[model samples]
Target: MKRLLKLYLNTFDGLSREVWWLALITLINRAGTMVIPFLSLYLTEDLEFSPSTVGSIMAAFGLGSVVGSWLGGKLTDKIGYYKIMVFSLFVSGLLFVLLQYLKTVLSLSIGIFVLMLVADMFRPAMFVALSAYSKPENKTRSVTLIRLAINLGFSAGPAIGGLIIAGLGYNGLFWVDGITCILATLLLIQLLNPKKSKVLDEVKVEEPYSAYKDKAFIIFLFALFLFGVMFLQYFSTMPIYYRDSHFLTEPEIGLLLGANGFFIFLLEMPLIKWLENTRFNKVILIWFGALLTSLSLLILNFTTWSGILIIGMFLMTVGEMIAFPFANAFALQQAKKGNQGEYMALYSIAFSFAHIFGHKAGLESVSVYGFDNTWYIFTAVGVLCMFLLLILKQFLKAKNIIS
Candidate 1:
C-alpha cells in the first residue's frame, strides 16, 4: 500500500503550481459540462427534431469549434494566452446563459455555433498556458494531470447533469453550465493573474515555426483527426445508442458515460507515468492505444447484451488514457517557444474538424446502415488511423524528429 501510494504521488511531483491551478479551473469548468452530452437527446425528445436535423446542428457546433480554435490561436499570439482565456470564459458564459431562449432549429443551430465559437476559444489558449506552466521534463505528466482533472470533473458532470435534467429540464443545464463557466473564470482571475505571479514566464522563440508549413505535423494531424472522430462518438451518438438499444434512462446513460471518465481519472496518471519510464517510442504507444479503441468499437458488434456497453467503454477508456497525453505532448514538442499557440491551435483544429464530420457521419451511418454497421465503419476508421500514425512514425524517424 505504501509503495502504491508513493507511485501515485510521484506522478504529480514536478508540475508547476500554475499547472495545478489550471487543472483546478478546468475541473470546475468541466464539472458544468452538462449540455453537450444530452444535446442530441434534447433535440430529438424535447424538440422532436429528426436525426438529420440533429446531425446538422451538431455539425454547426463543430464548425464553431474550428473557427474558435483558429481565432484563439491568432489572438494568443498577438495579445497573450492570459487575456484570450479571460475573454473566452466570460463571453462564453454569457452566451450560454442566453442560449436557452432559442427553440427553433435554425435558432438553436446558430446559437450553439456561436456559443461553441466563444467557448472553444478557451481550448488552444489553455493548451498554450499549460505548455508555459509545465516544466520541460514534466510535459506529458502535466497533460495527464490536467486530463485527470478533466475526467474527474466529467465523471461528476453527467451524473449531476442527469439529476439536473430530471429535476429542471434541459434549460437548467444551460444556466448551470453558464454559472460554472463564470465561476471558473473568477477562480482563474483570483489564482492566476500572470502579472501578479511571475512563475509562468513565457519563453519567446527567436524564430517561430509556422504550423501550416510543417508537412510532418500535417500528417500527424490527419492521424489525430481519425482518433478524434472515433473518440467523440461517446458524447454524440453513443448516448442515443444507449437510449434506443438498451432502453437506458438518462441517469443510467449519464452514469455509464461518467464511468468512462471515472476509470480514466483513477488509472490514467499511473499508467502514463509507467509508460513514460519505458524506452518505448511514444508513437507505438499511440498506435496500440488506437488499436484498443478500434477493438472497443468492434466489440459492440459482438453481442447485443447490455453488459457489452461496460466492456466497450472500459476498453475505450484505456485507449484514451494511453493515446491522448502523448499526443498532446507530441504536439507541444513540435512547436518552438513563441509559436506554441499556432501549433496547438492547429492541433485543436484537427479535432475540431473531426467534430464537424464525425458526428454527422456517425448519425447518418446509423440511420442508413444500422447500429452494427456503424460500429463496423468506425472500427475500420480506427484501423486506418493506426496505419496513418505508423506512416507518420516512419516519416518522423526519417526526419529524426523523434528517436
Candidate 2:
C-alpha cells in the first residue's frame, strides 16, 4: 500500500508545474460537484414525489446535459476554455442556488434541468484543456489522475450530501452544493487563464482540425456512444437493479457505490497506464464489456446474499474503468490540433445523450419489461458494441491508425 502511494505521488512529481496546477483545478471543480447524486433523492424524499415522477425529473438534467456538452465545447472553441468554464460554472451555480430556495415541484424540476445543462457543458471544456496542456508521455497517467480527483471530490460530495440531507433536508443539501460551486468558480478563474494557450503550442498539434471526414473518427465515435450508454447503468439502472431487482436496501446500495469508488481509487493509475495503447485498451474494454453485460443479466438470478450483486457492480466498474478511458483517450488522440475542444465537446454531447436515453430506458425497463429483461437488453447492447469495435479495429489495423 505504501509502495502504491509512493508510485502515485511520483507520477505527479514528473509533471510540469503547469500540469500540476491543472490537476488541482480539476480537483477543486470536481469536489464541488456534490449536488448531482443527491438531487434525485432530494426531490423525491424532501419534495414528497414518486419514483416514476422523480425519474422523469431526473431525466430533465440528462436532457440539459446533452445541450451543455455540445454548446459548451462550441463556446470553448470561440471564447476559450477559461472563459467558457467561468460562464458554465456561474450558470450552474445559479441553478444550484435556485435549487436551494425553490420549493414548487415545477420550479425544482426546471432548476435541476438547467443545473444539469450547465454542469455538463463545463466538463468537456476542462477535458479539452487537460488534453491540451498535459505531456504526451504522461497523458494516460494525467487522465487517470484527473479522473481520480473527480471521483475523490464526488465521493465527498455524496457522503456529505447524505449527512446534510439527513439533517437539514434537501434544501440544505442544495445550499451546500451551491456554496461549493461558488468556491470552485473563484478557484477556476485564478487557475485557468485562457490566454495561457502557450502550453498547447509546444506539441505537434494534429493536422487541420477537420470534421474528421476520415471515417475512422466517425466509426470510433459511434462505438463510444454505445459504450457510454452501458456505463450510465451505474447511476440510472444499477440503483434500481439493486433495490427492486436484487432487494438491497438503500444503505446497501450506498455501500455498493462506496465499494466501487474504493476499488477505483486503488487501481485507477496503474490500470490506466497498462491500458494506454488503443488496441490494448479496446481489448480490455471488450472483455470487460462482455463480462459486465453478462453479470448484469446473471445478477437477476443470483440475488442471494453471497454478495452476488456487489460482484456484479464490481464487474460493471471494471468495464467502466476499461471502456471509459479507452474511449476518451482514443477520441482525444484522433482529433486534429485545433479541434480538441470540438471533438471532446461532441463526445461529451454523445455522453449526455446516452444519459438521457439510458435513464429513460432504465426507468421504463424496470417498470415495463422487468429488471431481468433490462440486463438482457444491456447484454445485447454490449454484444453489438463489441461487433462494431471489432470491425473498426480491423479497419484501423489495415490503415495503421492504431499501433
**RMSD, every candidate, angstroms:** 2.7, 3.2
Candidate 2: stretches off by over 4 Å: 11-13, 49-53, 103-106, 194-209, 212-214, 244-246, 277-305
In angstroms, the error of model 2 at 141 is: 1.6
lDDT of 2 at 374: 74
Residues 1-403 of candidate 1: C-alpha lDDT, one tens digit per residue: 9998898888788888899999999998888767877888989998899988887888888889898999898888889889989999988888888987889989998999888888888998999899888777788999999888887787678778989999999989989999999999998999889876545445688787789888778888999999999988887789999999889998899789878877887789989988999988778888889999999889988888999999999999999999999999888878763387788889999988887788778988899998888999999999999999999889988988772
Mind giving the per-residue lDDT tens digits that candidate 2 earns over 160-234? 777876898777766776777777778776766655444742434445556446576777667666766766777
Error of 2 at 264 (Å): 0.4
For candidate 2, the 10 contiguous residues with the lowest summed lDDT are 197-206
Question: How many residue pairs clash in each candidate at the backbone level?
Answer: 0, 0
- Which residue pairs of candidate 2 clash? none
Q: Please report how far candidate 1 places residue 234 from its true position, in Å.
A: 3.7
Highest lDDT against the true fold, candidate: 1
